[model samples]
Target: MSVLVVGASAAGLSTVESLRRKGYREPITVLGAEWHLPYDRPPLSKQFLCGDWDEDRTRLRPDTMLSALEAEFVLGDSAVGLDVERRTVHTASGRELQADAVVIATGLRARVLPDQGGLDGVHVLRTLDDAAALRKDLLEASRVVVVGDGVLGAEIAATARKMGLSVTMAGPQAAPLQSQFGPVVAGLLEELHASEGVHLKLGTAVTGLTDEDGRVTGVRLETGEVLPADVVVVALGAVPATDWLADSGLRLDNGVVCDARCRAAEGIYAAGDVARWQHEDSLLRLENRTNATEQAACVAANILGDAQPYRPVPYFWTDQFATKIQVHGRPSEAAEVTVAEGNLDERRFVVHYRRDRRVVAVLGWNMPKQTRLHRHHLVHA
Candidate 1:
């Protein structure tokens, strides 16, 4: 059976690779909106943005490996519409491609502020082009204000500080990732950013952007305080890139709603950030690199008649400064965090997040191997 994959990122590539590995040697077509090859995104805010890694380093695979896949890679053409009944994808360049099965892995688009448009120094790190533009402005910038305090914002702040720019992190949360890791671990993250010369401007919302002569001058906060900046990076999260599928007749609530098997329709499946599938009692959508590949594999298997459900223990990681933080399982803000191994003050430790008196998540700070071992606690719990 021929398959049509609409997206050329990690999820789309993984789906094609998995299909071939599982011995499905039918014709495969991969469509992409961007001109570049499938590339890694996690480093866009850190290594790629900071000039430590070039554009070539961000590519997911070399040309030789991709050539071996024997699949058609259609780049720079976006899928604008879908025919649910006929399983045909209409592209922006007016090409209608029909297949036996269609996979939607469109991923996400970075959210931007209202006043961020038409400004010279405002940036958002979503794609490689976005990263390149931001890095260009950041090289000539002296002061930068990052508008968000989650993982992406924290990493951007750390990278800017390392580039010798005056960086300020602005957000409404009590600390960085407070809603994800709760007060204790997030507070420690705040300390790490503070110690690394990133000014903490948390607990307040960013009102707007101040501009002068079509260039950003500062970031205006809710409390009437304006943080001066030569550049501003808005890392305020993202929404599923499903606007093109508005008339597809498929369920779309926050994302492409799918069944437990990641199937949206008879021959339509979804994976990655754009897919919200049933997991046990609830509908879940994961927006990490690991989830992209894992969910793609599940979708590919089910396409090949495996009949398996996609149930994964959530996992994500971030590198800020010299610390590498890894989290296994979902940890709520209301969960109680307790040290499971090592000391919190020593800056290298593992902690368990408990809710309803049971371990729900494990987090490791600067300890990779030990933290992975402790992840078993989450699986057993």
Candidate 2:
């Protein structure tokens, strides 16, 4: 049975590798829209943008390694439509490929501001191309305005500060990462950014952009304030890249809906940011590299006829301003959070989220041992 995988990001690549390791000798075809090989994206905004790492350093697997796997690599070709009835996929390059099974891992695209002029100085970092362009702008930019206060935005703001560029972050929340880290931790993050000379404009919305000669010159906020910026990085987040699956009828909400085994429907599966799976009696979708890789392995195993379910704890990590933030498990809304080590003043600590007297999630900064202990506790709990 031949297996066809669409996309070359973390999920697709993981699925291929896992399948190969499981002794699947059938024809495996990997199709991707980008020309480059599958590469790690976590370092794009941090190390790559800061000029601390080169392109070779960001690659997840070298071409020689991928070729050794005996998988057919089709680059620069996007899967435009899926013929589920016939178990085939139509590519943008006018090729129809039939497969015994298919995996959709298209991932996501960077969210851009709407109704605003697409100027030259506005940037969004998602792909390698995006990171390269932003890195070029950062080299000569004196001031930068970042929209959104999520992990990506926070990293960009911190990187810009390190490069000696004045940064102003605008978001609707009261503080950065309020939704994920809680208000108290967000406050600490705000203090960290403030210490590095980052201007925080929380509880504000960017109404529009001011342009000169078709290039962005500044941003106009809802409060009628125009913030001058030589470069603008819109890190609002990402949306699933499933527009091509509009007529596929494989169940899609925020992403391609799947079961706990990463199976969407008969003969089809999905993994990565573009996949929403049933977890904890609800549809949960994670847009992190860890989730993508884990889910991909699940898909591969199931495809090999091993009916093993995917039960991950939902872990993620981010490095910003020389600070490493690691998260393990999904914190329930009713979970009570507690600090286990260090404090905000020390700039290093571990926060544990407990649900029903059992630690379910742990977030740590420079506290690897504590993080590992909590992770073990959750796994055995």
Candidate 3:
């Protein structure tokens, strides 16, 4: 059977690799909007931006490895529309392809602030080119302001400070990452960033971008204060790349709505950040590298008639300077958080989050081993 995968990132690549492992041995095709090969994204604000790892090192699979898959790869061409009735995909490069089965792993695109007035220094990090362009600016920038409170913003602020650039992070939340990790853990992170010389302007809104002669000079806030910045990186989150599937008749909520088996429709499946499926009686959408890999494998198995539910304990990790933070399961669902190992004073610890007298999740601050030992508690949580 001919299969068409509409993305070539982690989720799309994992699906193809896992399908081969399942012995499908059929003709497969991958369509990618970016010309570069699939590359790891976690390092965009870490090693890649820091110039510690070159672009070549970020590739998920080398040319030699990908040649073994024997799949037709169409890079630098984006799929513009999908006709599910005819099992056809129309591409921007004027190609019409047919497939017996389709996988919509098109993933996410970074959200941009339209009112930014098309300033030269305003950037959003999402693809390889975005990071490369921002990395060059980071080296030359003296003062930078990041507008977002999520993981990407925090990581970029941390990376900027590490590069000796003065970074001021502003977000609407009361504290950074409080919504995801809750108040206690987020409080510690706030202190960590403060100690490292990052100016935290939490609970603030960005009013506008101040530019001089078509170049961003600072970011204006709601409180009538303009934070002077040589460069501004908008790390606002992403939305699913689902516009191509608008007329395809598949359910589209926050992403392509899928069933417990990750089936979007007959002969169609979805995985990654673009696929929001049922998990434990709730519709959950996870946008992380770990979940993308797990969900893709599950989708591939279900496509191969394995008849298994794609239930996974969601996990994610981020790096900020010397600290490596990892979290398993949804800690925000827990009402109480208790320390399981190490102490915050030592800058290394594992915290256990519990709900209704049962452990639900674990968060680690440079303590991966202890956090891993407690993962079994989440299986039934």
Query: What's the TM-score of each model vs. the native?
Result: 0.99, 0.96, 0.98
User: How does residue 314 of candidate 3 score in lDDT?
Assistant: 84
Cα deviation of 216, candidate 1, in Å = 0.9
Query: What is the lDDT of every predicted structure here?
Result: 0.95, 0.88, 0.90
Cα lDDT of model 1 by residue, 1-381, tens digit = 899999999999999999999999989999999999999999898889888899999999999989989999999999999999999999999999999999999999999998898999999989999999989999999999999998899999999999999999999999999999999999999999999989999999999999999999999998999999999999999999999899999999999999999999999999999999999999999999999999999999999998989989889999999999999999889999999888999999999999999889999999899999998887888
Model 2 compared with the native: what TM-score?
0.96
Off by over 4 Å in 2: 332-335, 355-358
The ten-residue window of minimal lDDT in model 2 covers 329-338
Candidate 1 CA-lDDT value: 0.95
lDDT of 2 at 242: 92
Q: For model 2, what is the C-alpha lDDT against the true structure?
A: 0.88
Task: Name every residue pair that clashes in candidate 1.
Answer: none
Regions of model 1 farther than 4 Å from truth: none
